[model samples]
Target: EGRRRGSRAEGGAAFETARCPLPPAVPDLLGRDAELARLRAEAAADAPGGVVVSIVGHPGVGKTTLAVSAAHELASRYPDGSLAVDLRGTDDRPLSPRAALEQLLGALGLPARQIPASEPEQSQLFRSLLAGRRVLVLLDNAADEAQVRPLIAAAPGCLTLITCRRALAGLETARWVWLDPLEAPAAADLLSVIVGPDRVLAEPEAATELVALCGNLPLAVRIAGNRLATRPNWSIAYLAGQLRDERTRLSSLSAGDLQVRSAFEMSYGLLSPSARRVFRRLAAIPGSGFGPELAGVAAGMSAAEVQVRLDELVDVNLVQAAVIPGRYQLHDLLRIFAGERLEAEEEAAERSARSEELLSYLLRTATIAGRAFDPPVLTAHPFASLDEAAEWLYREASNWRAAQRRAAAAGRHREVVDLAIAMHWYSDGRTQQQPWDEIFALGAESARALGSRREEAALLNFLGWARYFCLGDNEGGRAAHEAALALAVEIGDRTEQAWANASLGSVLTRMGRPEEALEHARRAVDLSGDLPFWLGQGSIRNVLGTILRVLGRPGEALEVHRGLLADIEKHYDEAHPFARRFFHSATLQCIGLAQNETGDWPRAAETFRRARELFGEGGNALEEADAALNEGRARREAGQYEAAAECLRAALRGFTGVAAWWPRARALAELSTVHWLTGDAAAARRYRDEALALCEELGTPQARALACELA
Candidate 1:
């Protein structure tokens, strides 16, 4: 997928990438220095309708070559990153705007769950993610204006370079840089680069004839150069004789599918059956990408068998499997001609049916596997195949993820939601936010169309969780949560309501209304009592416990927490790492707070020590810092001034580099008391004042009081 950033056609490489930058080498670059400069000058915009450079040309006129080169020239200026996408505009299907955005989000390293399911949200997010980053985006092989708009970035300091066969020169502020055929001299230079200078120098007359016959197209000239380099004994005059015939002239460069069949046949007729089969079957792909699948469907062979055939094709330079671990596309002109062969020389219905079959197979598998991971709550399916379902979902994640957006274009909402939910397990580092986000967005539309408020509630609930927990957009999170809750109430689905409650609790937590968050959590837990595997329960308890301790209700909170810990150790899998840590943390914090409130300061300090150790085991630095802060306070209140200083310093050591923002104030406050006790009244006053300043800045009430009244 030569997947570049920003645009959508290509596969996304994971957003926020840190790969080795493109090397100094750039190829097929011609006559664009002035165009490049003009583009750079017009790249910036404070608002929408920024400079969109469209390089239009006929097929095989080197549009992509120039686009890539121009983007390369402008790469360093955009520090955030650069992106590229090949819109499949030339073939039967064109790239959808949402699919393109999804790929771009992945390449940009946006989270998979964060991708919006709706086109508008995807576009909005595409712009938002690009808003502050200085990135150069190249959209190559685009079909039309509608396909390009959603992926366009209008942010200042960001530039967009688009290459299409048609001139969308009408778009505002878009500088059109049309790539005509290369000049004979430039074509001659390129030919020289491929073949020996001596070969060109030896046949100047024939070389001029050759360039003329190629329509001065770079791809054609390059193919001619390759043929010449290999056939050292063949004279240019002999080649010219073959080229003089228009019937065989373009065919002279064709090696079957390697170049263009006419061009390739001109080149390919020189090869055997092995190469021809490789070219024809490769052209039969339904998707832009190919692997063993095309060889299986088109050539009626397995992956391993196709590899041997593909190797022969690659050896003759008829195929370029550059899409590591997958087969690749033939060149634009070449694919066009091969497709023509597939139409005339092969059965049309068979190929079309095969294409549909492949896509359907992908969707069905994606749906089943997706349902396995996140099965419908009220559905009749028991969701029992633990291994097969999960295995299938994991294996076909890419196809289903792609299918959700693909189906959305045709308004297939059920497939969109079903497919996205199946991909829950691997929705982490790879892929991106737009794919799933758009899935839910479309699912919302689909639910409305079907008049299924329950479905709408579920989609909104998923969207709410995604926005709240993944992206940290509190207002959006709150709205989505409310929307989900209202819809759930309308449908009278208690389970959906339960999820919405948990989601609302999350938003309230972020909104700093912990009291409301606790109430919401308690309601969700009560609703979840009859349900199975409510993962959110533990998370809710963790939040509620923290809130209660913060609100000075440690006694009530401890009784609830002790039972939770006991239940975790008894009914839950204690061998699970997360389970062990959760129980350890709840036990330690609740007990520590209760003891501290009851004036058993030594017991409070000891309990905090255990919590700190457990967090250290979990590699949870922030939680460890919290534990240390608690013990430091207990020590200071107990009048163990030196120990209090030691505990605060230890907390600082763990939190100094990390953003332990809330605990930093407490650590400073405890440290100031030590200073006051150690006979340094000036230092104590200074530390106290500094702590108060930090507390005020972060809006932490207790830290402010401690700093103002104590040390």
Candidate 2:
């Protein structure tokens, strides 16, 4: 009958139904009757509205098999024919959204030359073709939400069924059906269907154990069944016992070319050499997931190139896209398989070289990102925009931080010290009360290992600031700074000595030793005077001014800030707007704090407003929020309740968005006070409770004290 139909079609080419390009119907799909029935019901119920059913599961739970079975059963009902595409959601070369659309349009009888190149235009034409037609579109193995969203049947009287490892959370309209491993009864039934039912019934208990040993997963079961069917003499009990060992389970599941490892290898083999290297080395990443930028550094490739490879990996199901947009992860089993490949395929020296490349990239790139937060020095800025720098710092935090540990293990002491030196100022604000204490401690150890007194002194100086500001360990901070001062004096590094003195002054002030703090602040200023270090003088003076304000000497603090502002303006260059804005904004914020302390409410508010503008332009969200917080406090002091609440709310939003916990807590506390002043007791209590919870969670003494005061 098929031969007669082929001959007739050849004679009457015009009468053939344009050859629906659906793949051959799946030969046998056992124990999925309910799933198929659900799809049929959805397709029938969703007439004229269009139905999109997503069959999501882990690797090889038979997603493609189930979709194909449903398509074959429901094809006759849709008179307009069906279209099936292997979007290769898990392929190394997944089809692009645009290309997928073009293929679908071509299947709909559109000519190649007439199809639009742009995605939007192609989508419009596709929807037009699908309109008023009861066609079924089966999109198998979707890579991510973005890849499948465009292919969804746009008009009613159609159905689009997609299968993928990920949940594709971004696809809002699609009804999701999550598939797990088959149950014991169903698993045995499937095994029987594949390898003769009589053979399975002959040893029922052994068949049940065999299915369980296969993890009740359809793919494993099918392979096991195929292997047994070919070897007619092999007993079911013998095969089940062979797969009992966990280590050799993957090996035992395979018979010929049909293998779990081979399916994984097919995806891996399609990768470019660079991408393959990245995929295998990714086993070294300690966490479950990572972004492409970090993967790029590990692979020694550009971020753009790594992103394309990541898309390919996602398409083939070797990697899964995370809920966080840029992050990707491997399944636990796949991760182990990748590690096996890395050990077998890569030499020890090659692995070490890859580690070195990753470490060096992290140290260099992190230093560049970190320096963007510092007051302008004479050094060239590595990043073109502060926004780019901030994003890099946030997104790649895990990669660079992990690299620091790896560097320490490899004895790359000098790079470790230099990396931490760059983070000195940036860490103070960005990670205040975060885990920067351990980072600085590592830097100090690295410096000591190199036997460089100057580097040791510098690391110790930064370590003191981290202990005092971030860890709230005043004793540790004083001890570290004193050691740094001793080392600097012994080495005749006057610049480092001055920086150490300035750091000690800040620590002593926080420790309630005002007179001692004043002495150190004066020495820091005196020592910095003759230093040729570009940022030294202003850095020490800023510390001096801050101490004076802390000691109730606001008038002197104001004078010192005014002098520091003038010096910054004197050196400011119009061509280097980042440097200019960086210096000016910090100075303005300090001046605002000084004015607020002196009871000059209006001047403080105005200064804070100007600082906020500069920080906003520079893309310093944390600093911008700081200015807003200060302005809110000044307005509150002036009894401008409404204005104060508005400023505090804006500050809270910014701080919350960036996850700056300590400052977010502070903003919440301040906002509570503003609400209290405005007689909104409910709002005040709500904000106060949030602040108290955050303070308690962090276990910071200063934050706790502030929270108590609010209570």
Candidate 3:
């Protein structure tokens, strides 16, 4: 009953009754139950002054629809009347406070001639009219706090709900409610309602994908639903496939006047020119989110200036702050819109140049960060500390990964190979192995394309490590190392040959062929003897020690490992801090393994614990997890069940965090053994079952062997 009704007088002004001009509630409004409840509760709450609540979000997020619906539901509480007005906040000219007061006055049955001349006077007169009345004032699409402040009623019983694209945080007295895109299920339900439930039910997978392609924004979903509903003959999958292309996604989201692009255009048109430039250029960034430093590079602005522009964009809902502080992201649909603007307004040469600038910055910065983990003392770099370097590497990983791909695609072979080679040592400590596989594959291809045999051999060795250690592909690792060794020999690159031989030794050791692995390990050691400390000698020694331990020569392995540690200590002062910690940790871990094979459980446990601490200090999460596993095994053998369980759990956490399924499975199996030893059969069974499931999923030799032992 929020409709305006009365007979028109001779002057054509309606002889208004108690005014209720609220729009019709959207029937079965989906995905806003929580918001509606909060709005209604705020409206009903008693305050000294009238209650004012602002609903804020990006364009096409249904702020107006929600305000209208809330107003209609809460109309009964405001028995005197309810009034609504569109402030056109996203328009070229937003409604001024004076104009807004005039509209409210007219809605309250005041004649045009009787309205006050000044905005302050009009606001006073308007509040005076509603002083004792229980009215709901709905200011739809408010431009800012200034436009809303003057219009709020002074009566304590009154409630004013203002909706805007901006947050209007300056309204200190108002309670704020922010809207994100609908949740996936709610979005799917909304689509199900718009398209027949039967159709959605028939193609549930496609329906889910279609709503996701819509970015879960209500308006976009409704538009897609309408398009699908009208095209009865078209399958939902076909429509989803059409929208999958980012180049035409916005175009496909349009159905008549209901255009997602048009909705974005209105908000975009309101941005300052500089903000507009930054917003569009940000589409060049590859990942879902990016930090201010990268944005600064893209916009050619100082970080401080870029932050200011980012705040401006955030206020208007053009950009959103990510879960991580200081990072921002554009909505999927909005990113597409920005890309469209980038192509349309920017010159092709200019776009290419800007893209190259960003890519160059990403690669160069990544190289610097990666070097912090490499051998020898780290040279002068922008990062002030090892932790800062690591943080930048992980945070900007997506951006730099994309840059690598783009560079490779553009045939910038030298740059791609350089980045890949720089990341070799850094990749060892990374959380996931898959990224290294992709990176090294590109590096190898680029090196081959450039006909740089030395680089090719080096990248091939790195690729072998990735396949063997990261991916658990032993045969693939063996093949890659063999190929690298052949190339190294062909070119007479002794350092590359040494690394290739050591990599082969490690892979062969894992393949259950310690004898064959010993040959490779010994050859690698011989080759490494004449090379520099950082040129594979130290690493080759570690590989040799691991092989010696596997071949039932723990005493010899211990000797070799001790010698490696002694050598590392001599050059310790010359190594980067991260390299020092990481190498010491690695060597200690090898010594611990040898100690364990020699049945010195106590010493092995202590060594592994120290290695774990060193790995943690070096920020090598996966290696820390490995150290934890080793410690747990030693502790179990030493009859410390409680300590073993604790260490194993820590290992599980580290493995799970990195999504290292094989290692996680091993941790689970170890926990199962610990639990069984502690007389917890059910716990043991549960852990064993979980481990077996993962083992089956991995299908690796080690995984299968563990699975069989448990079975």
Best by TM-score: 1
Error of 1 at 529 (Å): 1.1
Candidate 1, superposed: residue stretches over 4 Å from native: 1-180, 197-206, 231-300, 312-345, 364-398, 407-418, 425-434, 442-459, 473-492, 511-519, 533-536, 543-562, 574-711
lDDT of each: 0.64, 0.73, 0.78
> Who is ahead in TM-score, 1 or 2?
1
Q: Backbone clashes per model, in order?
A: 38, 8, 1
| TM-score of structure candidate 2 | 0.58
Report the C-alpha lDDT of model 2 over 1-711, residue by residue, as the tens digit.
000000000000011124336666767787787788888788887645488889988766878888888888898888887887667565443666776775676566543333443566456556655667788889987899989878888678888989988888888778888887777888898899888999999999999988866667787677677667867898898777766654444444334212355445535655677667778887776443588877887677788988998887776567778645788877654666677778888999988787777678788888777776665542457777766776776566656777787788889888788778777766543532124666778888998999978888888887776666544578998999999999999988887888888878878887888788889888888888775323577767877888888889899999998998887767665324764575678778888999998899988998999999998898777678878999999999988889888899988877664445577789999988888888899999999998997777656678779867977
Tell me how far the alpha carbon of residue 353 in candidate 1 is from the true structure, in angstroms, after superposition. 2.9
The prediction achieving the highest lDDT against the true structure is 3
Q: Which stretches of candidate 3 lie above 4 Å from their native place?
A: 1-258, 431-434, 565-572, 576-578, 595-711
The 10 consecutive residues of candidate 2 with the worst lDDT sum are 1-10
Estimate the Cα RMSD of every predicted model relative to the unseen true structure: 9.4, 17.9, 23.0
